[model samples]
Target: MKKTVVVGMSGGVDSAVAAATLVEQGYHVQGVTLQTWEPEDNATTSKKWQERGCCKIGLARFVAQRLSIPHQVLDIRERFRSAVVEDFIGGYSAGLTPNPCVRCNERVKFGCLMEAARDLGADYVATGHYARLLSGGTRGPHLHKGGDPRKDQSYFLYRLSRAWLPRILFPVGGLRKEDVWPKAEAIGLPADEVKESQEICFVTKG
Candidate 1:
């Protein structure tokens, strides 16, 4: 039986290519975009959302169409806001610098979305995160640097469950940025040249 891999698609080039590569490798792939923020639809936030990329919500549909895979949008805004954003604000208020992305990886990325992936009958959840989860059910899930040291995101992913190690795939973990570009271009994604973002998606620039 083919394993069903639910990919956490962010509508970005790396994730888009990751899902494509999974398809080429013969996994039963589905794209699930976690809607982490309840957008205000105001001009300012709307402009920022446009600038940062839509997480490929609608574009995930397009990518699914292009790859002939299943796609779903899972709304995790309230959950993320409660867990990550609240912690961030509280931390900042207390004079501590909080890492929302790390909290988000623990709460939103792993906490909320992983449950959804299981509910959808997926055997595993995958993403384009640059961190690698090695050690396969040992050391409570060892999160480490990606093969591409330049883009490794392990620092933000140390809180994941060790049990989920075998089930998560970082398709772009080993590949450098230069290697990822052609895959995006070949897959016809729209954001080959878009700048990668920093800070939490909801945390606005000053």
Candidate 2:
């Protein structure tokens, strides 16, 4: 049977291309987006919503349809609040600058999401992160910098559990960020028109 992979699509060019690349490689790809934040007030106005990464569920669905894959949005707001939100707030309270992306990857993306993928009988969970997973090295598994140094995301993913490395995939990790949009467009995924996700998905700009 062909392996099944659940890809975390943020509706950005990288993730759009990641899903398409996996489909081309013969894996049964499923797309999932996490609804991690909800604005408490006017902070979540339409303009601000468009700026958050995880709020692009519409575009993610568009990419899934283009790839002919099933897509779903997982409401992980409560968990994200305790796992990442509180942690981020705590860090600031302690006068420390924390990397919430790293924490989210370790606790949410690869943590909660991987568990969900397993529940769906998927063999792996994939994302658009620009980092590569290498196996059978001198050690059991290693996460390496992506091929494109300018866009490598290894630093943000350094906190991922070593045990989960075997079941994780980053299809676009080998490509330059510059090439991701064109590839998404080539695959007819509409997310090529979506802006790149560069901000913290949960933080609202004041």
Candidate 3:
């Protein structure tokens, strides 16, 4: 039987290609988008929210449909607000800078997504994060920098629980950023329509 994986789709080219790569590798892939926040009433805020790569639920669904795989949304807004947003606010208020992305990766992405994967009877949880995992030593799986130095995301994931390492997968870790676009386009992912965003999903810029 094929191993089952629940991929965290951010509705961006990287994640879309990640799921597609795993599918081609013969894994039973299920796409999951984490709803971390709700759009505000302000038109500007709503529009900005939709433009973010991470908040594109509609695009994620479209990618999943194109892949002919199951897709679902997991709402974790309350948790995100408490763990990441509140922490960020409190940190700044206290004259300290806190990185919400790191906290989210530790508390929500790996923590919550791992649980969701288990609930779905998935053998592993995957993401488009540009990081690599090396296994086979007595120490178990080790997280390393992705092959693409420009896109390496290992720093953001440094705080992930070591216990989750072996069960995690980064399908696009070895692919170059430039190479991913072609793969996305090849798989009918509407590559031209998808724009990359560096902004935080829950935070809107002025």
Candidate 4:
């Protein structure tokens, strides 16, 4: 059987191309979006939400629908807050520093989303994350850069394990952004050509 891949599509061009590349590679692909953190009255976060590209579910769902793949929206609000969110605030509160998205990638995205994909019959979970998984003959798993350094996401994924490395796929890892879009367009990939999202979703709530 062709391996089944569950792709975490965040409604962005990068992820849109990722899914298409996987399908082109003959893997049975499924798409998913995570609904993390609802917008509370936290003005600070809300302001940031209004800023730039944040993870947006509507955008993600739209892309999934366009791709003609089954899309599931999983609520990981509590998990994000505890694992990625609180740790973010806690880091600043303690006068130390933290990387929330990295936390999300490790604790929630790879951690929780992987299990969700398994429940959906996926043998492998994929993301549009621009990090490549490298397994040398003897070296443990390492994340390498995407062809597009501007979009490279390996820094946030350094914590992913050697165990999980083999099960993860990065369709956009080898391709540059310029290459991704033209191909996606040729394949009739569905996703906004121009998206305004750049912040985490929950930060936008009222």
Tens digits of per-residue lDDT for model 1 on 1-206? Answer: 99888998876777888899899989999888887765333435334324563364655666778889988887777777799888899999999998888888876777655787779888888888887766635345577899898888888888776667777888888889888888877776665344577646785578
Model 1 misplacement above 4 A = 39-49, 136-141
List candidate 3 stretches off by more than 4 Å.
39-50
lDDT of each candidate versus the true structure = 0.76, 0.82, 0.86, 0.72
Query: Model 2 residue 108 lDDT?
Result: 84
Candidate 4 lDDT by residue in tens digits, 1-206: 99899988765677778887788789888988776755323445324324233345655555666667788777777877788777888888999777777778878888776887779878898888777877776766677898788878899898776688878888888777777778657655442344444455445455
lDDT of 2 by residue, 108-132 (tens): 8778668779889999999999999
Clashing residue pairs, backbone N/CA/C < 3 A, model 1: 10-55, 140-162, 141-162
Total clashing pairs for each candidate? 3, 0, 0, 7
TM-score of 3: 0.92
Top candidate by TM-score: 3
Q: Against the hidden reference, what TM-scores do the models get?
A: 0.88, 0.90, 0.92, 0.82
Clash pairs, model 4 backbone = 52-198, 53-197, 53-198, 53-199, 54-197, 54-198, 54-199
Comparing 1 and 3 on lDDT, the stronger one: 3
lDDT for 22 in candidate 3 is 96
lDDT top scorer: 3
